[model samples]
Target: MIAFLTSCQEELDLDNPNAFSLEELLQTADGFELLAVGVMDSYQKIPANEFLLIDLRSDDSRANAQNGVYPDVDAYNMDTNNGDAATYWSNNYATIFRANSIIDNRFLAPEEYQYTIGEAYFFRALCHFNLVRAYRNVPYLDKVIDINSNEASNYPQLPPSEVYEKIIQDFRTSIAFLNGGPQNRYRPSEGAAICLLAKAFLSQPNPNYTEAELLLASVIENKESFGYDLLTIDRDDAVNFLFDADPNDPTVNVLTTEEYRANQAITFAKIFGNEFTGEFSSDNLRLDGTFSNNEGLEINEEIIFSIPYEAINTDNVASSQSGLDDQVETDAEGFSNAMTASGPSNGVNVATLDLLSLMTPELQPVRFDGTFRSITVIADDILNDTFNSKYHLLGKPMGTIGLF
Candidate 1:
């Protein structure tokens, strides 16, 4: 019987040579920093860049002019192998697992690195919140995972209601530690946690609106202290950045070497432009590049929390897994960049007529005195007898690549 049982199962050594033990990592300053980096990397990989999955699921977007585009998700076809579902499940779990590893190792961290624990709590809550939103149920993994245990693979999912309790708890833990952090906008801040926790409160089945309101009010009322505010762009720079009065201007057709240099490190370019392209135009918001450079842009007052995705050779921080692979194609890159006028440029998703018209006439939303913030980026679609107005095209890529 023992032989039979032994024969039924295969065993393999599962030691990870590259991994550091909790004790080993906290022994030095560099080790703690490495642990912090692990948390950030895990978060960055969470498939948040896939807008087709998220937007197609909503009425806000549809496939391109091509027929049967992203049809499974567009049609709400939740099949067993739904790519979006699988992506969310796998990515969220990976983030949760990383966060759990950090939480599990918190005791081993030196006092100076205690903020790493807080960051893990926030990431854990964020990942769980994403899963619950997508699936309405998930294996809320608050405990450290044992790779050797069969139960790890066969873990059960919790209903969102129960999972939410854990989410709240995690956020509270995050806020408690992060509230006393260095106040870095790139990482989780006390205000960011409060904002997210408030959002979590609102997302509940029986939403705690009172708490949400209080949390939101605290951020808004003390915006300066909370490290949040709208960016006040110079009038001429804002206009020059986004629009071309004359779309036929040859000089504006492609981004010149000078123009690219000016916008290279700017958030406007990082989010809207593709890397290493002479493809800058006033009408086309590709001045920065297709995959927006999100590194230092995180601290921009306009941003709350951002996932950083840099191109090759653009290491804003000293980390190994910090850049994106090239996804070059004949006309289109591998990913979608919607920060341009759809018909005239290589924008994949265009604003639907339903949305554009709603924003026009009396229904127009407010914009700054001399800014393109609320202006519609319309592209003429002669084939469809309608104009495609791209709405809010900035910051198309990223969802926190940092694992810590």
Candidate 2:
């Protein structure tokens, strides 16, 4: 465990569990790139830790009942403590810690401070943004304070709105430091900072959608220069997107800033964006198993963000179904849904039919399936038709919110 302890003002001695200091590291230009690497680590760690998060809000879970992933989203449920919140919080703070140490140094001994600080600010903002979105409130690291200090100990989680304010401040500061600098393949620069700032402002409650749309558009326009593209797993091409990449190779382009900024296909497809696989069984129909219709579309170019599942390397596939069959028994009294009866990889996280019906009502009409036929429909008929026409749905149920 690294600890930031007493050190000389000339040298910001970083107590890294790893064997190097930021000053010694900055001797090489590559050291400047550590900011980017730290961000990558923070992002990837989200899905790697089993207890981090369960995306109950996933498409698969929201589409069926028996397969409902969480059954409940209440914080104290068995699922809440699974590790999503804790891991995400830990990783984000870890990145912030690194950034704080670097920024605290008064000397601009290295050429990379501008770039590194910008990246650090961006990451700090990014972490806070995600934390707010997932957990609603979290502790804000307001100053450069020791992690071991009593101050750190007594801090309480702040409101989401305040977190957004700090995020905006951080991004603005980062942008100023970067000074409209050109972007790098793997690092945050002026453009990335601007894009993130736009995102942070727009994502907060009561968003300024006008600015958000414009920022998103800019990201779309500069995607290539920013080193992002909607990754297509060409069936004709030999490599699969996830497992084929050497995990340890730091230089690999796993995802790009442009894709992230644009909310492109990859961003929308995030089963768990940073995790290596979508939280689904690789062999189940959603991709390779029973849900062939959706899975076929999922693995194709339309999918913007997905981690591949490799049954061969159990650890490598962040989500898999190797041992679930025995856990859920099927019998006359048991739920006879597709998920439990199928297999471990095939367990269902069913979403209410209402959601699917909202997307495409004609396809799933009343009495379409004996068990699935709508029991009741409530809502103003006129408004329903208007929304249906706008979204291209025939009808929708009242009070419908999807679960993954």
Candidate 2 lDDT, tens digit per residue, 178-206?
76566552355666676668878887877
Question: What TM-score against the true fold does each predicted structure earn?
Answer: 0.67, 0.51
TM-score, candidate number 1: 0.67
Give the Å shift of residue 120 in candidate 1: 0.2
**Total clashing pairs for each candidate:** 24, 33
lDDT of 1 by residue, 1-404 (tens): 99987886654447777787877776767665677677766665454434555665666455454434355556676578655567657767777777787788687777877888888899899888887887787888888878679988898989889999999999999999887577665577777788889989999889999999998888789887866765433433532443333457745644343343334323233222222233445453333222322334433555567554442221242222222442311011124223333222323344455555554422431210011212234423322322232222222233432111
Candidate 1: where are CA atoms >4 Å away?
1-23, 48-50, 65-69, 231-299, 312-348, 365-396, 400-404
**Candidate 1, poorest ten consecutive residues by summed lDDT:** 365-374
Tell me the lDDT of model 1 at 119. 85
In model 2, what lDDT does residue 47 have?
A: 36
Candidate 1 C-alpha RMSD relative to the actual structure: 10.1
